[model samples]
Target: MSSSPEKFSKNAVIVNELGLHARSAAKIAEIARTAKSKIWVIRDGEKADAASIIDMLALACSKGTRVTISADYSEDIEILNRIKALIQNGFGE
Candidate 1:
């Protein structure tokens, strides 16, 4: 029997003045796309595909919004951390 892969996640707050807008979402998606497993961004009970810019934008996360960045597999932990850092750093805005 095979067991599910370990999941990795981190929490971060949107610190950018503009929040998670198109550019920031795009940046996240870019990193997410490199993950070997699925990446998810969740906010206020709403989940968005980290690889989908539109899905992220739909979350409408504004400044100070808290979000969870998760990876379906432990192998993608670096991807999770990169995204978390990006959000925590205000997307470098």
Candidate 2:
């Protein structure tokens, strides 16, 4: 079987009111890890490993800041959708 790789993206929200705080970072981190594909977050031209919760929180995603989330993978549209939903849903905090 052949699996084609594709990318899906959306801006991560700065919804914590106090910005992307620990709780919000943790949520994004959790979702990123759950996916089979690699997720990367880039800010100010700098990139961080999305799977590490600590790294994410360190970005200090302030309130109203936008982070681009890109995913690359195959045979996992469902996972992609979930990730998208989590971002769209603002991590359900």
Candidate 3:
């Protein structure tokens, strides 16, 4: 029997003055695209594919919005951390 990979998640608040806009979403999608498993950005219980800029933008997360960065597989923990750091750092705005 195969065991399911462990999920990794981290919470971060949008600190950028512009919030999670197109540029920031694109940055996240860039990193997420390299994940070994799925990466998700969740806000107010809604989940968006981190690899999809449109999906992330649809969340409409403004500054100060709290979100969770999640990875489906443990192998993606680095990806999860990178996203969390990016959000926490306000996308380097």
TM-score of each: 0.91, 0.70, 0.92
Clashing pairs in 1: none
Ranking by lDDT: 3, 1, 2
**4-81 in candidate 3: lDDT tens per residue?**
323478889999999899999999999999998888899988989999999999999999899988887788899988
> What is the alpha-carbon lDDT for the whole of candidate 3?
0.89
* Candidate 3, poorest ten consecutive residues by summed lDDT: 1-10
Residue ranges of candidate 3 with Cα displaced over 4 Å = 1-6
Query: Best lDDT goes to which candidate?
Result: 3
Q: After superposition, how far is residue 65 of candidate 2 from its true place, in Å?
A: 0.4
lDDT of 2 by residue, 1-93 (tens): 123222455555555466666776677677778877677666665666677767777787786677776666653455556655765566676
Relative to the true structure, candidate 2 reaches a TM of: 0.70
Cα deviation in Å at residue 12, candidate 2? 3.4
Preferred candidate (lDDT higher): 1 or 2: 1
Cα lDDT of all candidates, in order? 0.88, 0.65, 0.89
Per-residue lDDT, model 2, residue 43, is 67
> How many steric overlaps does candidate 2 have?
0
